[model samples]
Target: MPNDHHNAPQTGLSYYGLSLLSYLRESHPDLADDADFIRTRAQAAAEAYSCIIRSGGSRIEAAEEADTVLYRGLHFSLYGTLANVIRSEFADIIPEEDAREAALILLPQAREVARSYELADDFAATPQYALLYTELTGTVQILLDNGIQ
Candidate 1:
């Protein structure tokens, strides 16, 4: 049989990354609108992938556990960063109530986007890995430029 995956381009993100970005931008414009928020969340997604691959070992249980732990860790990290940014940037400008409401509106959507990324295997040594990282961050940048996020 031919190597179906071999034809995959080495210098671009996998379809999964692109699709997730589109989903986040189209489904949750609020998260997409905040560049910092988007970047932080994208970093979380990338970190999750790294953790999954690093700690997965040869066991399925390990991979699953790593996924769970890293997902939660990165999620919390994103929230922590978000809080600090809001305090420094939005506290005096935007009313607390409005900021809270905006967060509520965007949090679930951001979580959904963050949760969509998963890794089945490690590709870190390959150009695809570079592409994945580039794509995730680039997606946010693209959205930012478009004023979508």
Candidate 2:
């Protein structure tokens, strides 16, 4: 073995984090702008991803592990944060209850998308993953734009 690991393309936490941030920026700028919150969660995800990769896990495995860490309690933490942001940012237009409801609804879908991405090949480069990301982001954008149904 000629230190082949070094030749491996970067395909773990960094890629996942950037992809996540990009999607959030596009679909949920409020969430994306929460640097302290996002960075804290991303750090935890990166740790999980790094641990899995260090243990000789495949990229998919590492991503799955990272997602698990990242989304642990998404309904509570992520949803609550989003709800707060929506409530405060759009207080005049969107009702607090609607913001809460939207956050709750979006979280499960977000988790599903994360799971789908973990199962896809080539990380974010695969068409399947790209499609999932696009669909989820679109859904988020729509919910934010129109409020919960």
Candidate 3:
């Protein structure tokens, strides 16, 4: 730590974080392409592994990067239970399909419906955000596999 009257703390942003944002930006069209929105989002996300591979980053790293942003974006207040589950089992996994699956099982039958409410009206509404949410969704699957859901 450097403390000087003339020098303030240095400033910088994470390239990985920026890359996560970039990956998120890529999801816009995918969601907007759906007729109902849910299917569109799911499709876009289902194919995220392929997309990230072509986006100049490994799918695992890309997914992890995206997840990192999500863990921060929602202020760690959302998906807490599901997140714990993911970490418990597939903490080493990339996007975490297990978690995503778990969330699906709970959604439409429970009150854990934050994506449609907290994010946009649907996936088509916010492309980048939707993509990020998808990553989070996969993390939920990881949790489900871990018996979190």
Candidate 4:
């Protein structure tokens, strides 16, 4: 059979990174400025993912492998760095308990958002994508507000 996946619109780590950067730009401009960092991680993860697919690994296996790469790269860049920045710079603004809670809430949600982009060809164009963006931003805003006073 022909390679249908090739014909389909790009749906992989690189596009997922861009989608993530777009979301960060809207919700967290500071992180968005780290585009080079994000792109490098995403590119490395994408290459690993493609290699698995080319090696005839099952889609599930490939995705699992990709997830490992993403966790080490993308997850660290976004969440780990955010945590460090918040703790170092804004620890006075946010309480330890609230920061912990926010991490618990946002980490999985953010992973879901990234997974959506990884799997969907045009996730950004979908209504659900908008809803996800709103929800994620709202959560961040609420956390910030709670921290303020």
Which has the greatest TM-score? 4
Candidate 2 structure lDDT: 0.58
- The lDDT of each candidate is 0.42, 0.58, 0.42, 0.54
Per-residue CA lDDT of model 4 for 71-119, tens digit only, reads 4523323344334435544568667656544454456545654555442
Off by over 4 Å in 1: 1-20, 57-149
Off by over 4 Å in 2: 1-14, 26-28, 73-149
The candidates, ranked best first by TM-score, are: 4, 2, 1, 3
Off by over 4 Å in 3: 1-104, 108-123
**Backbone clashes, each candidate:** 2, 0, 10, 0
Candidate 1 is scored at a TM of: 0.28
**Model 3 C-alpha lDDT per residue in residues 32-114, reported as the tens digit of each score:** 22233333333344355446777788778767654543333333223333344445645676356565444334443323444
User: lDDT score of model 1?
Assistant: 0.42
Name the regions of candidate 4 deviating beyond 4 angstroms.
1-13, 19-30, 73-149
Candidate 1 per-residue lDDT, tens place, 3-99, comes to 5332222224333334333444443333334444444444555555566667655456544553453233223222322333444455764466554
- For all predicted structures, in order, the TM-scores are 0.28, 0.36, 0.21, 0.37
User: Whole-model lDDT, candidate 3?
Assistant: 0.42
Cα lDDT tens digits for candidate 2, 1-149: 57433223223436555655665544444365555555667788888889999999998998888887765543233344445555665667668767765665567766655564454223445556546545555656676677554
Report the lDDT of model 3 for residue 89: 45
